[model samples]
Target: MTAIPAVTLNNGVTIPQLGLGVFQIPDAETRAAVTTALEAGYRSIDTAAVYGNETGVGRALAASGLPRDELFVTTKLWITDLGRRAARDALRASLDRLGLDRVDLYLIHWPAPATDAYLDAWQGLEDLYAEGLARAIGVSNFLPEHLDRVVALGGTVPAVNQIELHPALQNRETAAAAAARGIATEAWSPLAQGAVLTEAPIVAAARAHGVTPAQVVLRWHLQQGRIVIPKSVTPARIAANLDVFGFDLTAAELTAIDALDRAGRTGPHPATFQG
Candidate 1:
């Protein structure tokens, strides 16, 4: 088991830099997957209300027997639930499903700019945090303008901004903006959704590093200082995602991965996001 690294949030909370993401895993499979990840030494778990598997994730956590403080749990509010009243109640529902009294991190899943409810939603989250339901609060898929709006609303700056970031879509400018505000940017599709596993450079790097292409790609994310949540339901792949601590990428090798950036994004664009 590789030792996952940690990063200090803007609020000084420590989070495992690499975590297991339960994005599309079904309820039936999520429990076993999270259990496998935990046994493989992953301490952070990322899920969302939109994922519809929080109950299974909660079951896995309870079954692990690890103390609550030893694990980092993150969940999000869906765009459909983006009002002050709905947002407040949404956290409660998510908590009930997860069987956790409070979450390590909670987020507004998307800006939903067209819906124009995020500002009040931010206020709702602020209230929830003040009332002690979330240890830290953040956003997902928020671009610079969206972040500025949240900051302007007089709430604590979001502790993180999770996005689709792989070598194919590095989002350096967005990342720098988050850094400027002391918000840690997290990568969701950190592996390019597995589409780049066969790229020539990644393949050669894999051979030279005596590691798999997936490992090389994940290492690039780590070296970039981006918090990454790579998901897999298979037990072996879950273990493989966590087994990234033994090697370090050379400066040139890191540069090679950087060169693969083509402004390719496998997920939604922030500019066009409705949520």
Candidate 2:
């Protein structure tokens, strides 16, 4: 089993630097994918209600036979679940599906700024944290302004801000803002949906290190202090993704990759996305 490094959250909770993400994975395939990842030494699993596969994830966890403390699971509340009562109910439903009493981290799936209820949604998360239903609460796809608003609203500073990030979309400003407020930046599309693997910089770096382009990219995220979740259902790829802790990227290689950033984003814009 690879000894994946852990990053400490704002509230003293720690998360594995690398995890398996079940985004876009079919419900029938999620269990096998998660099981492959766990057997490959992955201790963290990121899922959400929107993914519609939490039930499969729960089954995998139960079958893995890994102790609760040995695994880190994360799930999110959808935009419709904003506000105190709705948020709590949504989390309970998610817990029931996940077959867990609590999650390591829970996040607002999106700012959904158009609805103007993120503040209320965050407050609900705060209540959950207080009630010990969630060890750490945070937001996802939030821009700097949205994060600032949450901080000003007062409660717990988000333990993390999960967003679409990769070499093509560096998202430096959002990351900087989160850093200033002691929030960890987690990369959702860390590989750019396999769009970056063939880029010259990544390919060259992979060649130089005798590793795969995907490994190089994952290493880049780790070197930059960003937690990354790369999703894959293929057994070989799932194991390959977790094998990134073996090498380090040189400063110049990191810079070359950084220069590949074109401010391109594969997901919805947080500033305008309603759900």
Candidate 3:
């Protein structure tokens, strides 16, 4: 854990570069999975209002007996809760569900770009951050246009932008925009939903590094300066994912991965996120 690095956000806050993502993790398994991650030395946990397991994650955190400040928790606002007032109420509900008086980082899960309400939703987050209900604020799945809006309105630049990222969908432009604005980048599906685990280069790199293919890929992201959240219910994989601090991928290896990018996304596109 001590060997893991930290990324400085636009607000000058330092967060763990590698974190645990509990996306689609069943409610029954959420506690055990998050607890396993925490015990294995992960201090940052990324969840969302839509994930439907906030209570379980909350219970795990409470039961772990770890000091709150040492842990960084990130959660998001759902599309249905996009208006200013509705967003405010939604965050309070999320706080109640997570059993946290204030979250470390909060984000707009998606801009719902089709609608014009994300700006209002972002204002809600800004208000929350100003009132100390959230230590930091950011967005998720926001394309460059959405980010430009956040900046144009004249408020705090997002501390991070959690997005769909993997070797197959590198999101170079979005990541570069975030970097130019000093926003930290977090990858939600760093493993590509297990679709790329058997890719030749990943497998070869895994053998070359004497690590699992997953670890090799995660290390590649780490070396490329991206925050990653690799999810797993299995304890061994959870432990292995956090063990990436020990290695660094070569520039050529990273270039090989960059070439693997199909500009293909396996998940919903941000521009089409209606809710």
Could you say which candidate leads in TM-score? 2
* Higher-ranked by TM-score: 2 or 3: 2
Residues 1-275 of candidate 1: C-alpha lDDT, one tens digit per residue: 66778999998899999999999999989999999999999999999998999999999999999999999999999988999899989999999999999999999998878866988898888889899899999999998989898998866999999988888888888888899999999999999989888888888888998999999999888987889999999888888888888888889888888888898888887677775
Off by over 4 Å in 3: none
Residue 93 of model 1: what lDDT? 98
For all candidates in order, the CA lDDT equals 0.90, 0.94, 0.89
* Model 3 whole-model lDDT (C-alpha atoms): 0.89
Each prediction's TM-score against the native?
0.97, 0.99, 0.97
User: Candidate 1: worst 10 consecutive residues by lDDT?
Assistant: 266-275
After superposition, which runs of candidate 1 have C-alpha atoms over 4 Å from their true positions? none
Which pairs, if any, clash in model 3? none
Q: For residues 161-192, could you state the per-residue lDDT of candidate 2 as single tens digits? A: 99999999999999999999999999999999
Which 10-residue window of candidate 3 scores lowest in summed lDDT? Answer: 1-10
TM-score of 3: 0.97
Off by over 4 Å in 2: none
Error of 2 at 198 (Å): 1.0
